[model samples]
Target: MPSRWIATFDEPALVAQALTALADLGVPGTRLVSPAPYRAVHLTGQPGPWRAMGWLVLGGGLCGLATAIALEVGTSLAHPMHVGGQPVIAWVQFGVIMFEMTMLGAGLTNFLAMIVLGAWSRRQVAKAARDGLRSDRLTLAIPTSGRSPEQLQAIRAALVGATGIEEAP
Candidate 1:
């Protein structure tokens, strides 16, 4: 038996209907591939890692800010260059370094988070592309590896009007 089933549909309505039907069948790992985003199809799943990413970025920025403060204050105190009645540690001048470090930290954290979180979707989209998915059509990939014969038959019945049905690679 194939590991997965692929169904292609030209009409958005059919794809939407097929998605709902698959959901009703309790099919897991059902993915939709479309040339453009469709308003009709709603994806309901766990919230993405974006919230965690935001927190991570905030932490990274705070760490960077702390590092910058330490560097500026420590170096100033250690060197102790009292220039023309100015204080040993100048808080106003440290703003540039603090801002730069904070931005650097947040940007790096954001990049790493994006790479890690986006990998799975990237692989799925690449698989869809390799399967001859077209820009003018919508494709649905349904995992069928653990499904019983009857369940497979029911899935096929649900997608009766699909333009094409094939075993996904």
Candidate 2:
């Protein structure tokens, strides 16, 4: 596979144009790497904000529920002390534990989710070298496999001054 790269404007139109160009060029596999996220880029797959948060909320909610049940179960098993002649499932006390568990789990889950998704992780800073970049710079890179010479020529022509053509494993 012949890996290729391109640098485009930080705006959405240019990013879309670059992606469209790659698609139009009939590249086999393509990807976009950016200093900051491009909203439209990741709409199709994982590592986006909504997906990360959705999983975090779902997992955290399940964990919270489980924690509530576990707490109630362990307490019931270890010390079956009755207060006010209440039943084993004391609603008020359980409610407090549930609320605390939900908030704690949700917050920690979200925090870990962001970190896992490479939100604030370190990248090779020197890679994003260009002039007149905006607050967020988006770079699109595409990898081509088993291409004909004509196709490679076409891609090479398209990437006139673009840089950063490294292959990923």
Candidate 3:
């Protein structure tokens, strides 16, 4: 399959137009790369499929809370202990530990998810020219797989004056 096609834009309006043009052309995997967050370019179609992270974090937090309760209550019940004449299953004392564990679980899950998704990978650097996405440049990328030559020509024609139009790896 063909890789990605990158079209660089200097203005946000151009990026928006290019996005609309590509979407109208039925281009798949269309995306934008910018130096910083900008609201001008409104993407079409469904967003990226990363919504699972929220569910993953929630599951992790719940598991952490359950584990915390089991450890604190189960240990107290297994070997009854008394400290300061308080209840053996000290709910108040366990609050801090439960909070810490819940946070730890969510944080660790987020970190691992990012790693798995290649969010920290250095490979993306090699795809474009140096500072291509920095210093007032916005890039619109579309994967060229299964696209006809006519479609590719149409995309090239749509992105007039693009800084770069190349097959991205």
Candidate 4:
């Protein structure tokens, strides 16, 4: 089983240093718990939800456009309505429906994505709170399981100047 070690740091710089040292040691899945956002310890190269949400919204709009096209064309073809020598399926008249449907689809998709992302972030925050997160200090949770004694010692040495260090129960 993997054991977790929690290290509390009074300063963001110390937390940042510890994170860099852990990365140098090739430690994976290290989590930083902080009450407020810290630019020093921000991890890069992670994909955010906005990209996925944009793709989803685009897909929804396309589906809406397809639906509008089918509705207008299918209905016109089913009951051919030729008014004032105009075409049975007029693209100009269908523009309003297509635009409205596309906007509606994109808006609804964006709204749902926001809800899901908000809930997911809330769950993560709750979990962090359970893991010794505090409002006045920063915490780093390092997994020491499957590590050799030398590696464990190196991890401890890296975090030597932290405010406090202990194993998670």
Candidate 5:
């Protein structure tokens, strides 16, 4: 049920226009990949790291703090062994474990976050499609499992207004 058909354009302006039109038409899973970055065709309407990633980072930080506090409290209370002239609850030494745990939490958060977002998933060649556009050319892709005849015709017409149209099977 996964397939892609790229709609090509010669200018970035046309790419953006068609993208906006298609999006307004309620097309889902649309993408635009071009040699040059086109600001207008961006569909996600979100910039920078996703909100979910921010939540992951915040949660990881809190978990790291909690672990560090638990370790420091439990260790100090159970076995109070003084080192040099410092008290048994010496924060200087405890800072090492805190730092290490914080780093570990952050690393694990990033790894898990990537996995959750399917960032590392392999691209199936069968579902991949492309439209040849020049470096100066702008393009868009509408990923669909089943496109209606009317929808396909509309997409073709919208793209044709810019440069040319090509659909992949």
Candidate 6:
């Protein structure tokens, strides 16, 4: 009773057509699996989560930069270092440290968000789809969680019309 179904098509163009037809029916979570990279067969209808992640990365970088500046300034003030009457907060000397910390914060935040938010677990590769994907076939996976029997029939009809091989539920 898995809540997913797949339809394999022979041509990439057919896959695109099927995707459009399914989208018209208001299908939400659809995926395309192909033997090679094909630009024509995009299936996901949801707005991607990358934009939010980019904001998070930017925040992390800013926090890291602030932390780096504070550390340098605080240490210099705690232990008076008057090297040739240089300012306590030497931006030039600490620029590399700030850059390094910024990168570290962004990297760590990206990794943690991917793991915790389940962004890394987006796609599930079935064995059948994997085999076909390595060959010369394209598969469209549609989530059938709350569809009616009539909707299912329409989906099957669309797949058959697109010269798809079989429907697996």
Query: Each prediction's Cα lDDT score?
Result: 0.78, 0.59, 0.73, 0.77, 0.65, 0.72
Q: Which scores greater on TM-score, model 5 or model 6? A: 6
Give the per-residue lDDT digits (tens) of candidate 5, residues 1-169.
3365666667777677777777677776666656765676365243334457878877886788679979897878899877787888777888888888887787788778877664432132223333353577655667655878787767666555565444555
User: Residue 76: error of model 4 in Å?
Assistant: 6.4
- Looking at candidate 4, what is the lDDT of residue 167? 73
Residue pairs in collision within model 3: none
- TM-score for each candidate, following the candidate numbering: 0.71, 0.60, 0.72, 0.61, 0.60, 0.68
Output the lDDT of residue 109, model 6. Answer: 86
* Per-residue lDDT over 1-169 for candidate 4, one digit per residue giving the tens place of the 0 to 100 score: 4477878888887888888888888887677777787964475223446568888899888888888999999999999988999899899989999999998888888889888975775453325324676787888778788889899999998885688877763
lDDT per residue (tens digit) for residues 1-169 in model 3: 5576777878887777777777788786676667766763347453433567798888888888888888889988999988899999888999998998888888888778767755633344336633366867887767777778898889788787677787767
Clashing pairs in 6: none
lDDT of 1: 0.78
Pairwise lDDT winner, candidates 2 and 4: 4
Candidate 2 lDDT by residue in tens digits, 115-145: 8755443232223322224465555545556
Which model, 1 or 5, shows the larger TM-score? 1
Can you give the lDDT of residue 166 in candidate 2? Answer: 39
Candidate 1 C-alpha lDDT tens digits along 1-169: 7788878888888888887788788886777777776843365232455668889889888888888999999999889998878788878778899999998888888888888877744565438534655777888778889788999999998886699988865
Tell me the spans in candidate 4 whose CA falls farther than 4 Å from its real position.
Answer: 35-37, 40-54, 70-88, 110-136
**Least lDDT summed over 10 consecutive residues: which range in candidate 4?**
121-130
Q: Which residue runs of candidate 6 sit more than 4 Å off their true CA positions?
A: 33-42, 115-137, 145-150, 160-169
How good is model 3 by TM-score?
0.72
Q: Which has the higher TM-score value, candidate number 4 or candidate number 6?
A: 6
RMSD of each: 3.5, 5.5, 3.9, 4.5, 5.0, 3.9
